[model samples]
Target: MSQFALLGKRRFAPFFLTQALGAFNDNAFRYALIGMATFRLGMSSQALSTYNNIALALFIAPFFLFSASAGQLAERMEKARLIRIVKAMEVAVMALASVAFMLASPGMLLAVLFLMGLQSTLFGPIKYSILPQTLHPSELVGGNGLVETGTSLSILLGSVAGNALMAVPHLGPQLASAAVIGVALAGYLASRAIPPSPATAPDLRFEWNPFVETWRVLGFTTRNRTVFNAILGISWFWFYGATLTVQLPLYTRNYLGGDASVLTLALALFSIGIGVGSLLCERLSGGKVEPGLVPLGAAGMTVFGIDLYFVRPHEALLREQNWWSMLSGAGGWHIAIDLVLIGMVSGFYIVPLFALVQERAERSQLSRIIAGTNIINSLFMVLAAAFGIVLLGVGLSVPQLFLTVAVMNAAVAVYIFTLVPEFPLRFFGWLLVNTLYRIRREGIDRIPEHGPALLVCNHVAFTDPLIVMACVRRPVRFVMYYRIYRLPLLRPLFRMAGAIPIAGAKEDPELLQQAYDAIDAALEAGEVVCLYPEGGLTADGEIAPFKPGISRVLERRPVPVVPMALRGLWGSVFSRRDNFLRRARLPRRFRARIELVVGAPVAPEGVDAAALEARVRELRGAEA
Candidate 1:
């Protein structure tokens, strides 16, 4: 079953609702506070700005201050009890907010903000740690995506409700306060539904000192390079988002020249985009954590951001009109379209990074690693604020600031991609294979986990190797003819993938020797090396005589051979049987089901090339 389908089952549904409600209430209360400051209290522009800035500082500061200790607490205690206590704290904080709104006291509002921040800080550790307890490893990404999408949607809805309710004049604060309290209460009830998540480190000592705990948690991250990098990627995303979201109010008022509706539109667009991207992650990742999408997302963010700078909202006439007026205006559609794409791609950018972090991190220290990530996020957010100030000082307008952020995104993406070429290389290969063919696979479990292994498959199409590479998580070195390996368009891909090029003895003895040496090295390093036993694609859609090259490799390295087959590509242009233009017109759409069937591995000593070839042909379900 798909990961998301597991979440719908009773074990996960309640916990999902609780977390979603907590996010909802947090935004609802914050927006309610903003609404009161703007209208009910007759606050000055300076005061409103100061209030918002202080609120941001107050909330984020707690994450850095308390996350380390809180993470350890989650690891040490029963997560269920801690979540309940946090929910209770939310109740009390919202009650205080009720009194603050009623009395119009700024002090009480700030206190409520700090308390809410503390509540979330306590909730953060348990929030992530609880998932693994209830979910299978495969379900983690989908569950995380659902939570992310739900949180974004809730914030969007909560902001609207808070603003709408707070506009009710006399009863605004009362109604808003009541609604927030009710949401918190509902969250507590949902917490009851979450199955008990046992602590991973039950006997672990709980440290109260944040500084000591911070380093301890960070220590756990040093062992895993991928996990550490994934955390950094997530932290970078926070910086990107905080830079944009925190500036929207100013951007809306000054650049867009619209009222509240402009802010609403921008936020709604961004959130909706994130939701779209998050949901689509499953399909894009093919049920595995793929970080290649990170660079893709970062690239889009930069390109669109730079474009947004030259967009000139005022030129589009979006600056002077209401939401409805803007929609009706000419060229407004262009700006709207751009914003939507930016938001959607940003979503695409973030979801996989989170999944990658979770998948790679050690289960025992996952919460601590997450805590370290939160600390880094807090630091980046502060940096974002500082960066924005510098940009503002240099005479950049809010729209121009957006442009600057976009360009910076490109630089950041390049730096990360360069540091980890695997991500980009895999993404490039996956893009080609997925776009080119409607591929399928069965019994892929027969593939070996490690060591020198040979993959023997019926030669089918030009793109078959790429298809196999995409489906298999581990990287493989394919042995192919020197000419085919050096094909104009395919050469760069082969180079990145480390494909070994060979030649027949009559063709080039030196190249053949290099190919053998490379294949041996790959086997010694415990990598999968794939080869076509027939030495070329099938011309008449039938199996050819078995060649001894497969046996020669086995005689040298003696690794397990996984027999695989590809079907449904015989008549296509990519297949050897058809001309390019003729093959391109066939194997129409969703009807294509090309299977990669892996039969049981053959023991090396007894295996012969002809026997292996016949076995592979049988696995392919081919009549010939």
Candidate 2:
């Protein structure tokens, strides 16, 4: 289903609007405070900078201090009720903000900023952890996409509204203040429509100490290596975004020679790019959580960021210009495209990581894990600010800082991908399969979401494993002929995927037994194991008699066997049709339509080579 369809559902729509409104209000108030400090307060440049930094610090402090408590609250109480309470707090806080705006009290506004931060901290755990409960595994990516798109657009609109309204004649502060309060109230009304999200751990005790509880929450986040690394990836993204965003105003004024309106235009383009990228993830991933996109995103961000630095406008053009004038100027479009592409790649990088965390973390601890993520995110943002300050203190120009960040991004990406090779391995496989074929999967849901299942398929081509990997959402270990497994170019991918290499019993009895042992071990670890029952690719584009080795493997570890069939691949470049060498020299069938049909799983006791072969034959029909 289209991700937009989620907007019409009761389960998602109300929460989406509430969250959007809250985000809008937060940005609106923040931009208003910044505008006041800069233009209206008559403060000197250094004092204005100090106040701006203080405001940012205040907003981030609550995530560090209160995320643990907030996570526990969401776990201990009904989520919808908690949301309503948070929205009500927003309304009260905004009312106080209105008073401060009228009285021109900067201290009160700063306190209100801290209050807004506290509210967001309380809502963070509930926002993310509630997704898995409300969305199916298939819908997680799409759902996350919609939420991210909404957030980016909200931030854009709110920033525009706050700054634009506050610049009005005489009634500016009142108008901005009223706008925020109205948004807060609207958010409360939306929260009222959210269906109940019952607490996951209602009986759990709460810990009030921020230090100890923060440690506990972070520990929960580290329980799974992949999930914890995914969180780090997310936090790193925040660091990147925070550093760039903080520099934009100055970058516009000094580097690009653009006025405030041009800065707004740049930000708008970035926001729109993120929204587009986030929404596209659902379609790109085929409604599954595809972490492969994360690597693609990271690569794009590094490439585009480096290109941005090289393409920055020369200092000769550093004179203030309006939005349109800036766009029409030399090097303007390049800078704009770079910023937009960077934001788009950031969306691709972040959405999948969020979905992976949601799908992988233990349910009862999911809230705490998200809370931990927020704490880390806050830390990263703070560090990014400090890093930027130090770089600037060392006399690096804004464009130079961009170059440094791009280089740092590359280094960090390499480190992370090396630590978890699965991401890059999957990216390569995903890229190859997606580029080579238009794969259609039928009855894919018949495969279990979790647990050990033996998958038996009639392999039609040498690329069958890649095809299966592309179609199935779960990680699968494949058993392949040793020769194919050791193919020079494909060996690394095979090894990374942990494919078990098998030899004929007559050729190597020890290797055959070891292959069986590996299959059994994979099943014991609750992983999906797929193997071609015909032992090798079909020579005549027809199902061969299934080998009995499957039965032997199941004898040691009896598990459900799912039968699958591949169609429209028999004559492909990778298939052994019309002479393998001759076929390899022929034109590749790029983007060929292929179908993968999955059959109902048969219990181990009922599974036989002949029956499974018949089932696969039925699925394939005469397509081959």
Candidate 3:
């Protein structure tokens, strides 16, 4: 289903609105404060800069100081109740903010900023952790997409509203004050409608010491290798975005200038780009949490970021006109496209990682894990600000800063992908399968979202494993013929996938036993292990007699065996129609129509090779 449809469901809509309103109020209050200080207060440049820095720091400090405790509190209470409570806190903060605005006191407004940050920090953990509890595993990606879309757009609108409202002549402060409190009240109302979500961890031991518990929270987060790295990926995204956006006003005024309207235009393009890209995730991933899109997004961000340096006007357009003049000027479209693409691809890069963390982290510890991520995110954003300030202070131009970040993104992406090779492996599989086939899946969700499972399928082509990997969201370890596993073009992906290389028992008994050992171990660890019970790719577009490898795998592991079939791949380029010589195959369809028909899993207790083969043949039907 389209992610937009989620906005209509009570399961998602209320929580979405509450979160969106909170984001809206946040940027609205912050930007409006900036407008008031810069325009109304007659503060000097130095005082204004100091105030902005202090405000940013005040906002970030609570995530470090209170996020872990907030996460624990969320775990202790029912989630909907906690969210409503948080929203109530927001209302109180905004009410105080209204008083601060009326007083026109920077000191009081700064205190309100810290309190707002505290409220946001309290909401952050539940924001991410609640999703997996509320959403189906299949809906995870689509749900994340909607949340991200709502967030980016809200931020843009809030920023615009804050600035516009604060610029009003006599009632700027009153307008800003009224808007924030109204938004807070609205958010509280929305939160009240959220369905009750039972706490995942009840009767858990409490930790009250912030410093010690903070260390423990972060330490526990590192225990899951993939989840920790995904968290890092998210932090890196915040760092990249913070650094880029913080420089935009100066970038607009100095580099792409026509007027301040150009800054708003640039911001709109980037923000809308994120919204567009976030909404696209549901369709692109086919409702699965697919991280294969990360590398693609990272690559796009790097490419366009570099292109941005070259496409900008060497000198600013110092005209009296606004964004309209810039939009119709030379290379304007190039600049707009670069920013939007950066935002769009960043949307692709971030949504999957967030879903991956929520989907993979333990439910009981999920809130704490999210809290750890928030802490890391806070640090990264601070570092981003520092990084930008240092580099720009030293004399780097804004465009040069963009280039440096783009290059650093390439480096960081490689490091992360190396740490978790599943990302690139899935990338190759997803890219290859999608490019070569128009695929359909039936009963794919029956493959199971968790725990040990043995998947037995009829291998129709060399691309069989890739097909299954792309369709199934969870990682699958395959036991395949050693030669096939060693395919020159696909070897890296296979190695990354942990495909166990097997030889015939007669040819190499040691290797056969080794493959069995690996499969057994993987299943014991609650991983899905897939192997073609037919032993090899079909030579004549027909199912071969099932081999005994299935028996050996189940003898030790005794896991559920999921039967799957690959249809319409027998005549494809990767099929054995020409005996493994790719160029020699005739009638090899590119972008071929294909289907993966999955049967309900058979209990390991009574499953057998012949029965599985029969089931697979039935599922395949007459497609081959």
Candidate 4:
């Protein structure tokens, strides 16, 4: 539970150190470039800002252009060796950066910046793709949190060190260059300590054309929808961060009437918030990679960002005030608080999504999928820049821009959940089932790893779907009645689960069409879709005639049909025969046995609706 335990092992420590140092050096070099442009070279503010913006643009650009290739490289090569090569490249780039600093050459500095971006792009796939390989599934969330927190902290420290050293007058360039080289050397040494990671795609042929290759990489998304959407979620976070991080300096100088030190305050506060939130992941997740936290984090980001926009910008500043002054609540502290909140929420938002992608992505294609993800992230960041430019051109102020971004985040989060409702709906069902049922699952291994599975179960209670979902490791889309799907209390819950709402044949033709389409899509996508074949809940604690819904879906897409039986929920409140007061007044320790017994998959050709129903009834009889 102690967060530091994440770094205590060989699996994590080396990679963590290497990544942390790289992040530190990245900021250090960027800061050094900014310093040389501004004070050392006697450039104007406008020129300095222009160079800084260009450096930012260059650094982020490779994520789009090279992410797919880098991801492929990660899949094809040994991660340990790849990291070593990457660190070596960093060393060479730092050497160029040293020369640029010594000569105070803007051209060389800009070129070195691009090299740094390229190095990061190459490292992107290996960086995240290696975690799932190295750590147990349980440790993934905590481990990612450590890396994120450390990276944020390193950036904060690196920026301070770079800017502070640059102010030393006599020792500025030497100190900055030395620091960059030192970090690079440390990263190289740490990378050497990394455990060897086997190649995911050893025989993968290298593609020469980036455009074509990038398009090919996207096909992986279609195969795994959850991983793909999680990738989108991650990219959206980058878009959100891009908008805020890029504007902070200008906001501090022009709006808050502060100098460089105030910018440091904003950065430090934000980084510290990330560290705090990241560390909390272990506790929040209860040591599991809980994707439920993703929505919560996204919600927080939007709410706090809006609050930040509304924060009154400080009109004046005391010159004597330093970093501590921002905390003193005299000038622009509201903006500082908003920054901290956003960073903290972002930490919570991102770590789980990354862990989910790693946990869900196929091991053989994880790196490639990660490569796909990096490309998307880069693309979104570009889109974010475009969005920012458009907003600015439309005469939006910094605060107003922040507000718009907050709204945009909310819209995007809803869109993602709508596209993949299982995350949120499952979370809802999970909460309810965990709270109400003491479920004991047996024969869980009977569920096939990859294939369509028909789950035939005895009617137990209205809450059966929730109980089944809670015990099953995978998400399930349940086929339920239109009325149940429209229950105001459970509508949000079902909506998220992507539940299929069916109408009786005589009720509505369009609803039936939608139901069949949803069921087909769910099974075709390799998801588990469950239905109560008895047509409705057992009103008299007896299984009814099996409905034809399961057979129809199975007929379309022949996969495994698993027959299940639930026992001992006949008199519960959720069951039909419950006497509300008596059931509520029942002793707390009811000592009931409720179970889900998974049977073998039914072959499509041999199974009919009646035959499947008979098998389910037999299982229920056996259990009873």
lDDT of 4 by residue, 309-338 (tens): 767433344443456655565435667777
lDDT of 3 by residue, 1-624 (tens): 667788899999999999999999998898788768765787764455446656777888899898889888888889999999899999999999999988989999999999999999999999999999888888899999999999989988898888788878888888998999999999999999999999878897889898888998898689889899999999999888877876675567567765446766787899899988888888888899898999989999899999999987265746534788887878888899998999999999999999999988888899999999999998887787778767866877878988999999999999999999989988888899999899998998898787999888888887888899999988889888898778899788778778899999898999988888888889888899888877777889999999977887787878888999888887776787766564653555878899999999899987788888889889999888
Clashing pairs in 2: none
RMSD (Cα, Å) for all candidates, in order, is 4.1, 1.9, 2.0, 5.4
> Distance from true position, residue 128, model 3, in Å?
1.2
Candidate 2 Cα errors over 4 Å, as ranges: 41-53, 103-107, 313-318, 578-584
Weakest lDDT window of 10 consecutive positions for candidate 1:
312-321
Name the better of 1 and 3 by lDDT: 3
lDDT of 2 at 71: 92
Which residue pairs clash in candidate 3?
A: none
lDDT of 4 at 41: 72
Would you estimate the TM-scores of all the predictions?
Answer: 0.84, 0.96, 0.96, 0.79
| 252: Cα error in model 3, Å | 2.1
Query: Against the correct fold, how does model 3 do in TM-score?
Result: 0.96
